[model samples]
Target: MINTSTMVAPWWQQAQLGIFVHWTPASVPGWAPPYDPAGRAHLGWTSYGEWYENSLRFPGSPVSAHHRETYGSRPYTEFGGDFADALSGWDPAEWARRFRAAGARYAVLVTKHHDGYCLWPSEVRNPHRPGWHTPRDVVGEFAEAVRAEGLRFGVYYSGGLDWTFQPRPIATAADTVAAVPRGAYPAYADAQLRELIRRYHPDILWNDIAWPAGRAAIRNLVEYYRFTVPHGVVNDRLYPYTPLWRALRLPGLRAAYNSWERRTVVSDEGFVPKKPPYYDFRTPEYSHYTGPDPFEITRGVDHSFGYNRNSGDDSFIGRDALAALLGTVRSDGGNLLLNVGPRGEDATIPPEQQRRLDWLGEAAGVGSAP
Candidate 1:
């Protein structure tokens, strides 16, 4: 455990604010990403991400219909077309400027989602990879840009791949009777993970889905931390039993000091109860995928953290909502990690979001970080 006195306060305490930015291949398609028909339908297509692997499993579900409409008989493996020209015009520096103006002290970028597309080039197991990869190391650029603005950088990685690939068992139904042979793909997982750590040196690593359970995963985590940053933080999403992992596996782990924010929809019920010492950080109280209601709280005058092409009103969070969210989260002794979805090209935050955040900066007294 890192000594609090000798150690700096976890970034959450110091930052008091963060930004959750979800950029994926789905972000490129400009269409609703695919979904798991066998699961919840309201989650929308991309909510479960690249569910084509499970499309056959569900057979003729709404998801399949939507996929057919979107791709027109094209196989799911062809989803790379979405990213074909998506980031070609992306500019990370401009993205950093908006985040900085929004008063974010740190930012979390999704390096890879369940779609299995890598934002940063990797030498690990490829997931339906293409001949031409993302022209630039998007993840690397994001980290550099965010840091240039003097914010700690974070990487959000999905642990489980959507079962749309050759090694298909990770996609097995939750209640499947047959146990799929769990291959030792730790090399692939570890390779990408290690590369991220070594290359960008992110301050926080936020993982989703299963935490890559096993001793070897723990070892890789330890080795990475010891070598890259002695004071970096890792989330508990990797462990089933927290206390054991907290004691045995975690040495430099942030002390119940969640530096990274959990991305999810917040409900009107106010604070979501978390396990003791598990900080939810900057998660939104509600999800846009759930559809809008009057009681729904959006960050700005525009009712979203990102640019919602489907929104008729073009919601942008205003000063009142921003202040309310900050006060509420701080009162609960938590940090807020707001989200922003930039346009696919030029990495520009929608003008509406920019205007509101600008107003917020001037009005909310977000002022200097003193």
Candidate 2:
């Protein structure tokens, strides 16, 4: 029998602030550098990065127009080479230093987004698109840097979607769910995740869109707990649909934390009812919320999570707004997860985002060792 009394809460709970990096091949041109609006009527303008390649799939979409005008019928895979060249100069240590200065207690990096480009070279080949991965071990280097700074390290895996496995681009809301790989993808993801565990031993496992609804997922998660990290932290996003997966897994295996990311309702919702659906912590992105329970608010320094050259000074979450947000989230008993979307060509945080970090760092006792 496991003794529940002696284990202390993982460091992530105490480490209030974090940095969520959203960088991928989309950052290369950096589709308008992921997801350009199609035609005048095709959603006008949007910045959801996972929809980058999808936008390119639309012949009349702005993404395709821009690509045709610029790259001229070049396949999306072509950008991988550009991204690789850019990543060659990436400085993981510099990023860690910046995070420490920005007052981040932990850092979550996107090892793989929906586009299916693995930041780390994976032995698990994508049957649909092999050799799409970079030679760099981005996850490993970043993990080392963050841990060296005494900050918790976590990885974000898109267990639910990998566009390489699906040829059709996601256009409508229905396409989002439909694009989920149903064949050998679960097992393929399983192999990659196992490799992640074996190679990185991440302190936090942040799976997006939830895991595949199958025994493979269950098995991977079980082994994750059993071997990789017995007392490690995990977020509530383990299941794509909460209502269904909530009852599917072992009750004891529930994630250590509950996260509500990418949702915009930021005002305080009185007291959070810590009942059946217990949430260790709540995440409020780009807004502030009121509650006694722990809440982590996320702020994307720029308009887009992935690199977007089009984002001007007006679109950025500059020093003033960031300062205000930091104060607000702090006062509300929450953490602020400031996001930085690095450029694909250089894997460097844009100058605008870095300026914001410098502002935060200039303040006294901010993002300091606690």
Candidate 3:
């Protein structure tokens, strides 16, 4: 087993609040169907604006219709250029200040999302899309700013799904599993992650979905990470796929697994993976887990983790609700990693999101570092 015992209780455990930043090319369009709490969990109709490119692949989906009407014949790749242009106005220091003022003890930025756009000018270039990464050193600037403000910094990378490698539209849980690209992807992800660790030395390594490589590779990476950053923590989503998981992709099994996954979400159980070789804490998205293990409850202030144009005041977590959530999570010995999805065009945190952060700052006393 991976020797997590060597490290003391991680800093994240005591950090009751962290800010999650999700800025991407998808933020340029920045639209998603209005989230319906009572509706079924359909991938195509997902409320996450960050999934715009994937959602566009589904014919007749709202995003597809929106894209066609808004930016006819313009490929999703073009958004990368638009996003780069928008960076001219982005101020990472201001972002760090906002996060610090919100009483965040730590801040985790999505360095790479599913769409395969790198926020920093990464040395590991995308093979399919040349120079797909941002010209701005977003990751470096943000990391520096956050640390300067005395808050721990972390990076979020989508290790399992890089649409540039597979470009598959995932509608089902099985489809998600199958979409984990094989071939050069495993090494590519590994190198990028190592680079993040080498450059940032982040306090938390927050990975999403699953690692495309199997258990051994993930274990090795975790070992290397702990060795490099002794106090750093890794979340549970790095669990690797097994032969049994691969079997879920079979047509007959795919439908069954998909049905079960949807049911789990509807029932509010969410999809927590079986324990991997090792993890410092569990991460549950838009779900709650009150078991014995340490976990972080991550969700957008609104229903979507990315800025959704459809999200209004009604869609946001109210001040009272947010306070209750914080109380409950703290009582259960968990942390809350609340997300902020800034408007891509101007890098402005929406007033709705800013108001909630302001409330939190006032309630918790701003500028108090954990």
Candidate 4:
């Protein structure tokens, strides 16, 4: 919905490499499977981390049953408010330094996850008031740090998928819908988002878990380009307005987002089903725990990039693997986005991960180390 006239940089020339950081208050305890009474693993908890609320639509699933039992059938706010101060030792500068050293052209940090906890102060709803409210403006500091290192800054917002804010789905017609109209919330969400834009001036808006009823919210966000960032790029996954506008036609649509990037995983079903044309860019994000050969981004290294607390082994892509992967993508004139899930509150990248990523940068002949 952003005005087409505001674009400054040609979409075809967007950065070829991006680093996605997925940190949530839930990540404080690290990645763990949700428990169930019958001892069967829950489907919702298994796929994604921290975004459990978005997947709780199934009626009799473990997440639903477990949530109802623990929180007395209330909304997700109850559990969201239960976050602890696990990251008293967070240092944003260290993280920025490492990311820059890793040759990341841009970085996406989690501003507000599905749990409804805002890393920076939010005026809209004190969703995580007593638990993790901070006056420090964490996201602002991240933007400053990232920009200082000369990398593009971005924020990953989950406003559309806040279980604490919109506990039940739009299909659930209840009094809650009247109290919180999805239509009006776009302005509130925009207000909160504007605070970040005012501070960070991010180049990209990475949104997650887009819903049907929340279309206006993102459209309003695009409209913001008229006043604020005229050249800002928004991911279609944010609110499903359209696939990222791109140039080179992959299997998907080649219209709006002229530079497209697909975040997929190695699966038994062959990298999961997607629309045709496959498109301009596709970055397969292998999780912490996956197979050896299939998980490898290239033919060389065997590793996983997504966060894994227990993964002490260098299961992620190594320098050789990274170089080869980037080389392959570059040969085709596409981009690569490596993801790292930082510890909650502890904003710095883990020391071990940093060392390996540094090695990758060195091996790939990218990024100057600070």
The RMSD of every model to the true structure, in order and in angstroms, is 9.4, 7.2, 2.3, 9.8
What does candidate 4's lDDT look like per residue over 221-323, in tens digits? 6567435866666543443323221111333332212122223423421232122111111223332212211111211122222233544444445566666
lDDT of 4: 0.51
Score candidate 1 by TM-score against the native.
0.68
Give the residue spans of candidate 4 off by over 4 A. Answer: 1-14, 33-42, 45-47, 52-88, 126-132, 168-187, 211-217, 240-307, 312-315, 366-370
Q: By TM-score, highest first, what's the ranking?
A: 3, 2, 1, 4
Query: lDDT per residue, candidate 3, 114-232, as tens digits?
Result: 99999988999789998999999999999999999889999999998899999988876788888888888999999999999999899999998889888889988998998999888
Clashing pairs for predicted structure model 2, backbone only: 26-30, 27-30, 30-33, 31-34, 35-52, 38-61, 86-345, 103-367, 266-288, 268-290
- Clashes in each model (backbone N, CA, C under 3 Å)? 21, 10, 0, 22
lDDT of 1 by residue, 27-140 (tens): 433333322334432223223323333432343555456656666766554545556466676778877776777677888887776556677767665644544236568888
Comparing 1 with 2 on TM-score, the higher-scoring candidate is: 2
Model 2 lDDT, full chain set = 0.67
TM-score of each: 0.68, 0.80, 0.94, 0.65
lDDT of each: 0.51, 0.67, 0.86, 0.51
For residues 46-151, what per-residue lDDT tens digits would candidate 2 score against the true structure? 4644356877877877667777888887888888889998877888888998888877788999999888999898998888888888898888889999989878
- Backbone clashes in model 3: 0
Model 2 residue 143 lDDT score: 96
Model 1 score (lDDT):
0.51
Which candidate gets the maximum TM-score versus the true structure?
A: 3
